[model samples]
Target: MRLPPLKALPVFEAVARTLSFSAAAEELHVTQSAVSHQIRQLEDDLGESLFERGGRRVALTEQGERYLEAIAPALAQIERASEQLRGVTDSRIRLAVPSSFAVSWLIPRLPHLQRQHPELDLDLEMLADMPLMSERLADCFITFRYRQRGYSSERLYVERLFAVCSRQYWNRVRDELDEAGLRKRGSGVTIRPEWLTRFTLLSAASVFERPGEDWRRWFAAGEAKLPADAHVQHFSHMLLAHEAARHHQGIALSNDYMLDTASDPDLIKLPTHELQTGDEFHFACKTARRNEPGIRHLSQWLVKQAEASGWKV
Candidate 1:
């Protein structure tokens, strides 16, 4: 059948269902004659009498019932599609990042990125509780990973992890050494005092495996180990671990960037060298959307920002 004007479908459907042109007109905020005119146009186009006139009312014929059933679902589907498109049109660029990185590095850097690119809208989401970036959910992700396989990705930074302890703890070590008569016997290096009995050891999870010890790797590179059966504490959240360290609870395995919030004297590096690790920050996008301009712009901007911040990208 030939299609009537798109605007007429609602008029025809309302009149057919209500079985009264006046009732349909009242519901649609139109004149009864206008409703009747639209229904007549629809019936003429389809070449069928969709309703039978009764005493001051109307009843739908078989064809009218069938048409109403089909049009009701079609109208419902259109409404749903409209809502979905509206949601997408209003969506912001969603980003997933680690909590420590968000608070320390990204928070400070966001204003700069915004000043540089005012059109680059973004939403930063911290994923402290999640294990991996759920690919289906996130548009862009920032995480510390050694490798970037199975996705279109760009390396943002290679961060150096460091050991941070409270100043009070360092002073205690100085007092202990003076009493031990080792004040002049060794360098002022705060290597955990004994090979197996000095201080508590705290380590965060590895970037790769269960035993991914950021501390052990850093210590190994320095040819050193904590002196004692240091009460080893493992926490999933880097921020929480840092907080624990701040309270003089334990030595936290923290990266230099993560210590941006801690007071300068609160955390101290062992041997005073940057700890090397294979882990690096990477921004990953779906492999299918790598070529899209917005995605590419974001990926490149993140790399450029890292470089500008003196981080190795």
Candidate 2:
């Protein structure tokens, strides 16, 4: 039987997964030069270039992505079998999620997950930006929808964004705005978009984004001009922005999944300026393992939880 270089296969998978030689080297507990050499040897043996190397950045070539898909499941199975032989009961499912979602949505409902699936354990890797593939980082990922050839993806939730701030903060700001004739209450809470500039704007880096693109979109949706010099404070994540808003720091943008106005006595909405960004969040996993009991259970539970929380799936 003809076989490929077995040792080189793991090196290729690690490099393709991380898209960084140094990262792959660290993961495999080997030297960076050793990783490069193994990759070269693998490419020589296959007669196909697996990666596109440009300066310090590395990306998998089409061939490499396909090759990784072919091997990743096999590798995972082997690891599982080895663990079992060593008396390790590996029921842990790793889930990668956006940091804000972890804090505001998923973490709070974790007890339900435990009650529903007592046999399985969960390990969460909360990230500001989710990786594109499930093969590299964790077993499953909650992320934006994009076509990945060998992966199964299902739309899980969408954002319903609106401005929010602490009720206490608004109590003070309301009188200040009323004094300035900026508070106009006519038919279910309405405000001029430009009026938002009077108070500090709490910007979440993941939502408000660099150069204020999402913020611009929200202003455009409201048909209000975004101030050229709006006073803005930036937070690295949405939860931090929310926390800041809760403490009377500023107005924070919030989504439906993260906020339950009925339950949260601390927050009040800007109202009537809601913007559905049309960004779809998806649950994704390797297509080959989509039906695995543990993965399927988690995915369904997540969908159910989102639906219960008013996510339009």
Candidate 3:
């Protein structure tokens, strides 16, 4: 049996499913005219009209609907076979990761993973908020949220917060303290936690508002009290706060996962106490899809990377 041009099947399928040539073109990474030309070719080859066009909208005719029903399952089978042959059951893994983590953590390490699994593709969606845990939105999600809503998940790492500032800012503060003859205490130069009040305190407002992830909790954990009139600047996102601190704007509280030590050499970590926020990073997916070859490979790779960074699990 002869096949209706193999190339046209996908174009036809996409248009039929979306009912819009523009949408189909976008999904196929082609122009709208390209989709129209392919559809025309297919219709001419089949000697029947596949779509009923009115104004700017189009719909499948009876023949087109019947054809779709017949071809969709066959196309799926072909895709599955191709994936199986390639030893990657999922050709692409759509991952939803937090923006900060994506920028500071995952991206730096992506090259290694891509090199190892050239046949596998990763589609990353950097989201500010938690992603909807469904196949429609993403194949997997890496998040700090504890609530998984019954999804299968593996703990990746636990984040500990500490104070950080630009080296330039630290030098200026040290010089001022030295000029005032207040830099040394006991046997060495020391800056008290209260000294932080002297500088503008840059903070992520949302993180501070979270139960155990606040400046008050961090200060308390360090056996210090936050000054009542601490100079402060608030940011909604930690990435911005970190950047602010990097630029010598102020001191910012940073967590382990959000700071790339190698990338920002000028950022100096303040020798202050650390506080565990009780939040664990995790990779989550639908329970049934956990064992898929692509998901399993990615999960194992991520775990290995996390373990290399001193995370226990």
Candidate 4:
């Protein structure tokens, strides 16, 4: 049997997702009229009105919802197949990863990936959470997972987190702590985690399930009690927290893979202890396509990069 207007499926999906013809048009880079035309054509082909339209608002009818559920995955798979075929001519691996990882880790080392595999081109899609393999939005995914599932996932690193701040800020804080008159020995001033309460703790919620939790754990690990009035500045992602710390705003918890102490002279790791969050960052792909040449090579290259970047686990 012939399929309903295959070209219109994407337009329908986009419109259904956004619930606005104009929004879908903008996303598809088409005029609003074109989006409506495509939806109309699709509805005609399917012999069903997929959307309930009323005065600038659009809602998916029951049929529309069911249709979307069935077609969305198929569309995704078809797109992946097309990309795979194109990848034969040009080795392209579409990668999805957390935005923080992209900014702090992957983007910096991308030149190295290009030099090592001149043929491979990485198209990174930034997301806050891991994409499901079935979504087929990307050829590969990098995620921090609690445990390994049956998918073709390779453990890239067991995350090691450390408290870090700009050298200038750290120095200033140290001076303040010293003036407060407590731990001072020889050339180096001793640090107690309890002193962290004095300055703003930059909390990146993405690192843990909740904001400020990492700081609490970090302090606890150092045998220091969290002060009742401990100040915390919250951010949604590590990149934001890192930015604040770089500007001497506050101290932030940083991931080992993302934190380059040798290369980044401005940001210094605190003398305090590290937190082993048990968070595992994995490079994974759909098991069905795990052995695909591009994915396999990409995975190997990433694993090497992770190891070289001090991912001990």
Candidate 5:
């Protein structure tokens, strides 16, 4: 036996669930007459009345209830199956991101998208190059850049660095260093007199350059100087540097997104006072592929998820 046209199922489902053609019309954003027409067509296809009209209200008949019970689960399953197939068959997106952002911002927020759309497959790649529209290897790229160079370069987030140290570092000398004693060290966090004499200051690699931004600026503001013979470490990626700090190796200058993104609870900020960097993290994709269905969906969903999760970068 031939079944009803598949397209009218949504119109019929909405009306049946709501028990009112007007309500379904409002939800579907269609005219009441349009909803009535589809339901009538569906009834004719099934050779029965699906709804009993009682004045303005509509109630499903026995057959209508059975049809809903049978069709609802099938329709829902079809929708999910379609997405799964889309995830596999549709275009796959390749993302190249800076190591810092991949770890501290985008990586943490990825689960939201995966949970919301399980069928969507994502491939993430990390790099340090500035994101640009003309990149050859990436469908999309996220990187920290100074300014927008073209239409595809849109600012996703702007962040600045703060002084952060390990939890061990904080607890080790919390009792000995009162607020005043700590202030004497100038920019550093307060430490006990004994701890101050021994604990060395941490410094970043000289090559890790951000214009007008560094621990030095922070030190100058507080009239402090790095302790002599303090240990210095070099890392090619900011994430690696931050990880070192999290391990209690040393304190480091870091950004809010970096701090928020770290999985290790060992790292903590020294205080609210922070150094500001005008540099911004940007999102860039090829102009042609920007509107493609998979990329578009991911772009919109990612932005919303990131904003809701509180990591602006």
Candidate 6:
């Protein structure tokens, strides 16, 4: 037996299951008129009225009910088969993450996760900012300072802010300042708090300017005062600032979560300052999706990694 246009089946199923053209359209991300058009086309092809339309609502007709029963299982089987062929189960996770977090944290750990759960597939959407929970853009979101009422959330890490510079930049500054009449203590050279103003400050314009997470706050926390007029280069994102610091363009205020102090020999954290912003990283998703196998597994893995790294949960 040949199939009537396969595209219309999903439209029909959505409309039949919901019994509302508008609801089906919303679920299918189309207009109600488009749903009606597809249904009309399907009905013409089958030579039957699939729905009984009332004043405002709709109900599946007897033929429609039978058609739904027959096709729903077939569609489900096709979906399952497609997933299987793609080497995944019904548990694929669509995760939305901040671009900086994805690059600094999640991407590094992805290889280990893939090794552990080869059957799972993760689709990552990187956004500059956290999306509203109501948008439902992805199955889960990993972000900083995100809180929503209807969704379930788990803390991943608390952020500690500090200044970071390339080792080459630090050495160049130290030598320059020492030659320029700055005192050197014994074998080790000391950089004064005010000396930070000498270098071009790379600021995360968006991230730090969010209320309490600013250069002023960091300076206060470190007991260092900024000069009235300090030369600063601003970037909209922390990732960009980090890159600038890495390339020796300037010193960047960095969060502990992104900087690997032990392994990264090129970047060095400047002494005498750390700011605890009370804000934390979190993994969140709709409560309904909390129990899905892929979500559960990924959430657990994230929590484990956080704990292993000694980050606050």
How well is each residue in 187-239 modelled by candidate 5, as lDDT tens digits?
Answer: 46543222333443454442146422355566554555544454455555566
Better of 1 and 6 by TM-score: 6
The C-alpha TM-scores of every prediction are 0.58, 0.91, 0.67, 0.73, 0.57, 0.68
What digit string (tens of lDDT, one per residue) describes model 6 on residues 71-170?
Answer: 7656755765787898866667778888888888889989999998887889998887654443234678887646665578889988887888999998
Give the clash count for model 1.
8
Q: For model 3, state the Cα shift of residue 109 in Å.
A: 1.2
What digit string (tens of lDDT, one per residue) describes model 4 on residues 288-313? Answer: 67887778888998888888887777
Best by lDDT: 2
**Worst lDDT window (10 residues) for model 1?**
129-138
lDDT of 2 by residue, 162-249 (tens): 8899988887767676778765633345776777888888887777467466567778888986788888887777788889999999
* TM value for model 6: 0.68
Local lDDT at 53 for model 1 = 78
Clashes of 5: 1
Error of 6 at 212 (Å): 12
lDDT per residue as tens, model 3, 1-313: 9778889988998888778999889989999999999999999999999999998899999999888767765675577677789896466889989888988889999999999877778999877676335443467899876365447888998878888889899777776666667666333444667766777888786675652246777778878887777877878888888899999998888987776566668797776778887788899876766898888899999988888777645
Candidate 1 per-residue lDDT over residues 82-120, each given as its tens digit: 856777442345788877788977888788767876766
| Alpha carbon lDDT at 232, candidate 5 | 50
Of the two candidates 1 and 2, the one with more favorable TM-score, higher being better, is 2
